[model samples]
Target: MDTNVITPEGYAELQQELDTLWRHERPEVTRKVQWAASLGDRSENADYQYNKKRLREIDRRVRFLRNRLSKLRVVEYNPVQEGKAYFGAWVTLVDEDDQTLTFRIVGPDEIYGKQHYVSVHAPVVKACLGKAEGDEVRVRTPDSVKLWEIAEIRYGLAAADR
Candidate 1:
């Protein structure tokens, strides 16, 4: 498997999530599981079944987080990677239709449309790497390859100023 590269921001986010899962979520679910187990006939109890499934899910996530955290290498902010796109570059691109999309290239764990984070291994991010501003790149997808131009590329997390 390709080693996942994580930025400091991504690592911190994962730590926060792990902390929440362990300190808050786990305890709450454990209480529910206990309450469900106390009820008679666990095999037939709906609460027991639901809670058991939830506990299994939580445990799985916990294991994933632990393993991911252990393997990740947190990237520190460096000024040298400014001009060229790299794994943690925050890039802004414009599609053929002139639609603009802004995203940060991080690791797999940090990716989601809502988070504006794309995995470094993603096709689009991979295409954008080493590409400077005003460069046109063809991003290959399972459906069809789309063309996009690098309108802008900026680093630093959070807002542009931050």
Candidate 2:
């Protein structure tokens, strides 16, 4: 099962998408479908067929977003999480070669379509949890063990500075 937790910002983003699709795009597409259907002979009318298909897709996405929003639990940043890796943290890691990688640890649902956002369940994330800056994490990949050091950890609005 996908994790039910989401950062406050991630929750707002999902809510905004739902609002745009439902209140704006859905109405616009519905109008197109109605106008096309009025032309009659839907089987032969390309506009009608295409709009009908688009409407179904919109409806399916709306249903999913609504259900997901209802079930998600927003996780806000806490002062206690300072100086440690945790959910909603922006972590910068340095490998043995001094190659650096940066990403935010978020829920599985929130990671979709986002750049540099890793799922909380990801192996690298699991290995880094509770680790402080300068601590080494041995992440076990399918190929081999990779060592990474925590270069930095930032949370909440501080993360936006990057």
All candidates: TM-score: 0.80, 0.94
Distance from true location, Cα of 139 in model 2, Å: 0.4
**Runs of candidate 2 exceeding 4 Å displacement:** 157-162
Q: Could you list the CA RMSD of all candidates, in the order they appear?
A: 3.0, 1.8
Full-model lDDT, candidate 1: 0.83
Model 1 lDDT-worst window of ten: 107-116
* lDDT of candidates 1 onward, in order: 0.83, 0.91
The TM-score leader among the candidates is: 2
Candidate 2 residue-wise lDDT, 1-162, digit = tens: 348999888898899999999999999999999999999888999998998899899899999999999999998899999999999999999999999999999998888787889999999999999999999999998999999999999986443434
